[model samples]
Target: MTTVLIVASNVPAQPAVLTEALERFKGRGARVAVACFFDAAELEIDPALAEIRSFAVPKEQIDKRLRTALGRAPANRKIWLHAQRSGWLMKWARTADLLVAIDPRSVHTVWEMAQRNVAASACYGLVPALRALDAGVSAPVTTRLERQVSATAARGVRGARRAAISSAKTTLRKATGQKVMGTPAGAWLWTRAVSAPKIPDRYRSKLAARVHDSAVRAGRHAEAARAATAAVSRITNAATRAELLTKAAQSELAVGRVPERLHDAISAQLTLADSLLRKDRKRAATALSNAWSLASNRVLHFDRLSSPLVDDPAGYLAPFRASEAARLLSAPRGRSVPAAPVPSGRPLRILLATLINDNFLHEIRQRYEAMPNVEVRFLDLDDDPARRSLARSGSSVIEHKLAGHTPYGEKIEEWLRPHLDWADTVFIDWCQATAALFTMPDPGDTRIVIRLHSFEAFNFWPHLVDFSRVDDVVFVSDHLRDLSTAVLPQLLGAEAPRLWVIDNAMDLQRYARPKPAQARFNLGMVGVGSVAKDPRWTIEVLRHLRRQDERYQLLLIGSDLNAKTSVAAKQYADLLKRDLAELEPSGAVQRRGQTDDVPAALAEVGVIVSSSVRESFHCGLVEGAASGAVPVVRDWPYFAGGAHGARTLFPADWVVDSPAQAAERILAATATEEDWRRSGQAAAEHTLKTWDWTVTQTAFDRLFLTD
Candidate 1:
């Protein structure tokens, strides 16, 4: 019989692995013990494996001062102090035949003990430790000495680099710290030296570095950092101080670049991230984002990557898999207990939820509000003034989702936890915010249903959801489901929720209006802002039509591409503008900025064109077809080989693989206005019969009703 002990940090998914290891060992007459400094939440052990005892000293008992002091101490000293004080660890360690350090932070303490106890085997992970305990191969003593020597050499190298950096930083700090510029006389002297016209870029950077070094020597980090930052800025050569500092910080963050002295890189990045965030600049936000990537730990050198927490909530956060934070984020569903034999039904309760999009909810709410058994409520997280202010400013954004878990995640959970407790079923709309908030797992026994549309699949939100609590995942199309499952591995976990495919709810009855005869030769496109839309191809098809007959005109709808979002977007907008410039004045094309009257917009489009590379459903094109426009869809390259997308959404003849093919279809349809009207009439009937809200509402009903 063997006993194994596992010591770990409060990482995401610890309990599941712990339980599995115990189960594997139980067959071999092995007993396991577990320990943690932080709460475990994301996973739980089976009752059979619950015999494993894990120890923890209350976080409140630890002193912040001591923690800080320990952080600055020598490596061996830190381990010695920690082991001596953490008696729970020592007590548990004494009984174990095999000891495992579940995280890097816990590895040192285990190593320290292994030096004193030669009979026990030590491993880095649960799997390795369990294997060692089962096989019964104990660690050798002289081999331990060799391991210690190698570890000491590695630590020495890191210490030397950190020492060199500390020395240089001190020198720079003193040079820049002086209040020299604060005095008029000193400012004048500094101004003359910096403003020297003939000083080449190389010389200027050298002088700036010297000045910065002087500021550091004077004991002023603020002044030194400032002088260094300023000198780097003033040197005209791109390779000067300013460029060098940024490069130095970035290069130092490269994998294994400066693990020991990496604090400065993180500090520089945060300084820049905060500055950009304060000023509300998007470009600076991107630069800071790159800085964060380089600063991340590749494997185990630094802190474990947050990507795992965001990507695979259950598996990655296993250590914290069953804590209040983890449970609140990932609620485990209990087996059905047959609803306590209802003698008499009082009323039905319905919870209405839309994360950021409240589009179809108005009608859904209206229907439920009139029912005696149903209660309707609406919550918009973005409506909060603080969040709104952040979105409007778009500054210092915390690199999308890494920033997601902080202010946004906490505020959302606080607001939604109560609602989740009471509602029998919560319908979370739009997989972005809705899925993310509900996935935090405080279900309070309420059933969770998340609806996935097109864009959410491409983003980081779905990855943030804790699937343990989600009762049902609703996808708009099979193609979206396929893509989402392919990109996210956690969705396939044992606890993953059942999935349902339902079309988007659109009131197509409004688009059952009449169309003008001239629309027969017109090609209309709605929402051309994204590069994924590939509107340029639509223009090619239009040009081909015009060569055969000038009667064909294209109508473009929606606001132009936004320059604020990205440089690539701005560049694409420029090229689009040039294309529009030639076509608009020639009466070959028309631009309608934005309008609330969609039925009216569809009226002028006899031939609706969907030119996107991918789409979950393409609601606009369907609406246009219902308005009597013949639909022509690009094969939708993103899902061309997948199970379903634009091709399956529309009729077989309606989908075209290329611009040339689209032009061919247009030419045949508009051979005569009479012929075009007949073809469009058939398309309108098929669209209304197949994809209208009347039909889609049934699909949604079945999904919500099925357990």
Candidate 2:
């Protein structure tokens, strides 16, 4: 049998290539053996080739002297050292008729083995080894001598060149070290070098990043920002300039601080997006997506008490307004025909569509399904994997809109066009990815209605939606409508869809259960899982209440905040843990995490609080109110002073401006059991009459049933 040996210093880049080469060798009647430097389990070779022997080097068995040398050596030289000490590998190499190195790291080891075993034919790759075998000859004597002479000459030149490069790298590392970068003179010298005229863009960007990172580590953040700014200013290419600034911004965000050049980075990316909009839409979409990610980072918005989006909506979004690429995304793509009135001839076909969130749709879906005059089909893209992937691809949607058509656009048509043809109207929840995707293909005469909740107004998805394809846009509260319109001016344009403020449909009657007199001392909050919920605000109110009456306790109902969501989230979560540590053990605060039966959980709550920084309608608070819990709402900061906000949405006395005000209201409402019961009863009656499904369903009917 002809023995063939293969050496791999690392896992094969393409395992299938090695597997196929092995099969071909076995078919030609050669016995195969593999020497793996890495763990054998990492190689996913076919188990059918069980007869092939695999020899793996044990890392622990190597001597200390050899291990120390291996650390400083190149990967190719390290493999040679490992092979020299492995007895099994040496035996296999000596016996093999054909030797092959599967990757560059193993080449040096194979070359040394070939010299020791001159009878064997040596090759650097599978194809070369196969060619050697096909030729039916080991290398000619003259060719082997010439190869040895050439290798000796090349080694001398390589050794000298490597020495020079190593010396230069060592000097450069010292010059940019933390001790040097901490000094102003060092920072100035590097900044000037990076921004020097005629420096290649690729090299300048890379050097700037290295210098900035070193300076930041040395506590010279201002100098790092200057270096990046100077480097970016000198970059002639818009894309490169955007990319370097974006990297600098991301590095700061990764460390949980807002970038100093955040707006500059966003503006640079928008400029690049605009320049590439017509010629290279895929690239433009990537640039725009990067800009959006930087602008809407959680550290700047959700984790903090105030957000730029709420503080200055127009100023925060000015870059997007100036970009032609963003304009194209928002540009009206009018439907061919206005939706026909709900057909009188047959039952009205209503399709309810969303990506994954169906929490808000249960009431509306059940209402329509029971109607004798309506036919209902609910489509959640998540139900089908193929459709789900297409729905979630926001970049592809942006590209398709800019290009006017793509294979992705065709797939969307294939997936949703049939449903559009069948339905009289489609009500899509959350003006997010699903809304943008459904609007990709013209809805023909099928009415498109999208509901904009609170979160979408702060993100990029609302811009991606084709509003002209929609017949009506629904908002759960007037405050949400105001914010959405301010963020997206397309809503007020000539081709904009009809905007309506419809209260979310909720079943309030189920929560109107009797509460025990002891419940008068219990304060409750339903949803505290997100940063926006501001559970810490409720904790502060609990602190105030407890100082006056030690009997007062707080109940938090929902999942704990997820720290893994972002660095900002982790910071907030860590602080929340400190608060819980002091209150949780003393019976002052309790957690009744995520329960399906909200009504049962609310039976112990005497006062319900909405401490969120923002909300579309604060559904949980309203639900608690429906259960006879007196509502204490913090004027949602995102829309506190707006024309139509929590103040206008709820009764005048229900909204409070601060934690102290909320504590005062809660104390007044729960002073006496009789007084608390009376207050809760009035709140319950108002919510049931104003916000219940029975009352809101008529507005939906007018939207769908009427033209």
Candidate 3:
């Protein structure tokens, strides 16, 4: 009997595809074993057909520091690193007659398996596997021991060569990773290597990025910046220079430090954009789009505690404003036809769209779906794998906008034009890629309304969005509106859309569950997914409260922070893990990881804390408040002292400046069960009356209902 091992990076979207393939294999007298990166339990199959195993490496098992360090490696390499450790996979791979990769992500695993099991036929996808089986090769006479010996010999030779190369690289990398990079000798050596004659542009850029990452890690920012400039200067092509510079900037930003050459990278792209504008408009738009992408990277702005763009919007984006190509990109590409009037004859067709975050859209969708006068369709841009790629970058859309043609444009037209024709209004939830893609082609009488929450104002996405094509721009808060308009010049222009500050739709009624008297001393925080959430600040508050009364314990709800998102996130998570280690063991903090029933969880808490450094809207805090949890909100620093801030958004009593102040507020409010209940009841009433879906749905109706 023929033996087959099929490795899947993820569960197949259609399991029947795999099941059918398995049946065909079984009919051919093949015994199939399926190894997947996901859980075996999640995939239901006929037990007699195939043996299944999971090779999923739990997030907690992977060393985050190592993962962060390998951030620049190819996706395949990342997958290989995790899967290679599974002994079951090794044994199955060695014994199989044929190895199949169910998806692209599993191809590398199969490739590696092919190297070890030289006798096995490795192929990707079911069709390829079937073809390989049809075009059968003679079975190898080599025994398992002989194959292992041959594989070992091959690996040994390759290993020797790799080790020599690795040794040299390690020596160089270590030097850069230390304070040595700051020294004249280290700088001289790097300068020589980067500027070495006959070195290919690709090699030079690779060397520069490596050295840059190392230097940045070592805190030698100036040296890293110098190395990047010197390396890019050696590369003659403008595109190559811009690409290298952008990578360098991204590398720095990933680690939570703003590169000194970030402005230089943006300037390089602007120069390239201008050069391409006269010769090739599409390439120019792409260059400008890339510049905008770099300038607005979340790592540089929103994901961090501070943003240069937020500090001085006009100043930070001044380079783009000065560039002709950039100006062309942002220039009004007005709609071919005015937005169609909301038909009195039929229900108003509205499409609600967002990339990934749909937390705030639940209520809007429900309200509109329930409305007799409205017809709603929800489209998550990230839902479709094909559209997700298009929504990832603005270059393709910009190319289409400038040249009037692109594959992305055609695909978008084919995919979205149907929805555009059906809907009288498209309410895109974020001023990001989804907004940019939907607005790439003229709306043709379909009103485009995009909501800017918080992060988009700090990123390049809003710049890509055609404000002129949009009928209305919505903001969750006045502060977000002010910040967005200040950053995006098009929003300030005459053709700018009607700006509206509409609070996010939320159902607060479910959060009104009664709490026990002991809940008065229980503090809670709902989300801690980002560094901007500043969970450490919440910990400090808990620490302060614990000094007064150890009965005050923190209930941390929601998923743990994702350390893999960025270097900053990793560092923050490390700190949080350390804090949790101390508090959790002592029973001072309870980490009730992600749960579907948030309202039920909130019932255990008396106080809710919003410890974010920046927030357009603290939804978690609001939800908690609506759950009869007294809110102690840190005056969100991004807009704290601005014209509008958390202080203005919430009641003056609800907002505080520091952990000490937050702790003080919590203590005072929860001094007695009566006081705690009263405080929570008042806060709940305020959120329900002001920000709840019942109150906000009318504003949404007006936004769509208006001509």
Candidate 4:
């Protein structure tokens, strides 16, 4: 068998690339041996490749002399020294017909081996080695004395060139080292050099980053910021300027510090996006998307107790409003024809569409499917990989808008035009990617309706939607409608789609189960998986109640907060862990986790609390009320003191402004067994009469059946 040996100084950056090369080599009847300087466990090799063998250099097995030599050698030369002492690798190298270096650090080791194993074909990189194999190995030809002398001269010249380049790199490193950057004069000198005229944009950006990093490491953050800003100001290339500033901002955010030039960085990206819109739409989309990501980072918004978007919506969004590219995204594309009237003779064809999230559609779907005069069809873009990709390609949507027409736009038309032709109306569940995609192509005479839930109002998806193509916009509550209109503003224009506030459809009757007497002091909360839910606020309320009466305990439902979402989320989760650790072992806080049998779970809860920072209409709290639990709703800070909010959505007595107020309400409502039961019964009756599916379906009927 033809033996092939591959050497890597470190773990392969792209294992799939190495795997494909190995498989190709095996197909050619080659027995491969891979030698890695690092541990073998870091790379997961397929056991099925039994013909291939791998060896990891065991540091413990090396003698003191070799280990000391390895520690002192440069990174690349150390690989060569390690291989020279590895008996198993040396044995394979002697017999191998082909030698390959998978990475740059291994190239030097392979080159040294090639001088000893002159008969074997050697190459740097997998592709060059593969090409060498394809050319077939041959015996070395004899050379004259003159040719040998000439080859020696060429090697000496190349070695000298490499030495010169290494010396230059050493000098550059010293010039911008942390010790030098610690001084004000050194920092100022390097900053000026980076911003000097005629420096290549690529080189200037890289140098500016190095200087900034060195200054920051030397405890000169202000100097680092000034250096980056100065360098960016000199960069005439829009893409390069935006990229450098964005990197600076991201580096700050990664270290848990907000960037001083955060707004400037966003503005640079938006300017780049606008400049590239017509010439290169894809690039423009990328720049715009990056701008949005930086602006809406969790550190700036959700992870904190307050958000700039909430505290100062107009001021925070001023950058987006000023961007021409953002304007193009929201630019109205009016429909060619108004929606056709509901079918007179045949059934009205209704299409319900969403991407993966079908939690809110079960009731509406069942209601329409059971009706004889309606033909219902459901489209989940996620069901098909190709369709899902098209639906979620926000960049492609932006590109199509800028270029006026693109293959992506045509693909959207091809995929959705047939559904539009078949359906008299399409109801898109969330104002997200699905909504934006549906509006990409004109719906012809098919009416388009989209629902804006609480979260979508804070996301970029709503901004991508073209409201002129939609006939109606639905909100679950009046507070949500008010917030949505304030955020979009276009919704209030004369040409904007008709807005409606329809309560969410829910079957609340199933929750009317008998509660045991002990349940009167147990509090319940559902859906604590997001930062907005603010489970910590609920914990605070629990603390207040327990101070007065030790009988009160909290039953936390739903999944735990996902800390992996963002740094702010992780900080919040850490604080929550500390709270749980204090109360959980004492049996004061009980975690029931997630359960499908929510109504049964409600049987143990006497009071339901909504301690959210914001909510459109809290479905879980209402469901608890239907189960004969007194409701205590926080004013939902996102809309408090507005035209409509939690106070207007629920009864005035049920809403509270603070944890102490919530505790007082809970105590008064549950003063005695008779009073508690009577209060829960009253709340249950109010919720059942107002928000149940039986009561809300009529409004849906009027929406779909009449119009």
Candidates sorted on lDDT, descending:
2, 4, 3, 1
Candidate 4 — what's its lDDT?
Answer: 0.86
Error of 2 at 604 (Å): 1.0
Alpha-carbon local distance difference test for all models: 0.63, 0.86, 0.83, 0.86
Clashing pairs for model 3 are none
The Cα error of candidate 2 at residue 650, in Å, is: 1.2
TM-scores for every predicted model: 0.53, 0.86, 0.73, 0.79
lDDT of 2 by residue, 1-707 (tens): 77888888778888888889888877877788888877767777775552333445466966788877788787778878778776877898887888899888888889888766767788889998888777763667887687667666676677689789878867887898778899989988987788889998988887888787778778788988999988988888888889899988887776667788889999999999998887888899899888888887887777766788888889989998888887888788788988888788899999999988998999999988999999999999999975678877878887887789899999999999889999999999999988998888889989999998887887788888888888899998888888888888889977788999998889999998889998999999998988889899999999999999999999999888877877777888889999999999998889999999999999999999999988889889999999999999999887888898889999999999989999999999989999999999999999999998999999988987777
Model 3 Cα lDDT, one tens digit per residue, 1-707? 78899988888999998989999988888889998888887888887889988867677777876576347558886766666777877888888989999888889888888878878888889988887788773345765557668778887987798789879877867766556666768766775677676778888887888777767766777778878878887898888888889888987887777878889899989999889887888778878877877887767765567788878888898898998777766667788889878899989898998888897788778877998988989999789986678777667766766666677788888888898989989989878888888887878999899888887777667776778898889998998888888888677767778989988788889889989988898889998877888889999999999899999999889888878877766777888899999989989989899999999999998999999988888888999999999999999888878999988899999999999999889989988888989989999999899988888888977888877
Highest-lDDT candidate: 2
Worst 10 residues of 2 by lDDT: 48-57
Residue 595 lDDT in candidate 2: 98
Better of 2 and 4 by TM-score: 2
lDDT of 1 by residue, 1-707 (tens): 67677766555354556666667877777666666555433346564653433334455765896686566777645544555576766776766778788777778778766654546788898778766766675556787577667656766776699799879867644443446644545444543464466777776665554554343333333443554555555665432432445443333232212332234433444445444553543434454444434433332111211123224434432322222221222233333321221113554455777645787566566655776655666767677766543332212233333333456546556767787756767788877655665655356557777777766654434544667667778887888887777655556677677788877777788887777778787799988766667677899899888998998999988876554443445555677788889999988989887889978888888899998877778888888888888889998877776677777767899999988999999888878888788888898888877887778777765654445
Q: Which stretches of candidate 4 lie over 4 Å from their true place?
A: 1-204, 207-236, 255-259
Best by TM-score: 2
Off by over 4 Å in 3: 1-184, 188-211, 229-240, 280-286, 381-389
Clashes per candidate, residues 3 or more apart or on different chains = 42, 0, 0, 0
lDDT of 3 at 135: 79
User: Residue 361 error for model 3, in Å?
Assistant: 2.7
Worst 10 residues of 4 by lDDT: 47-56
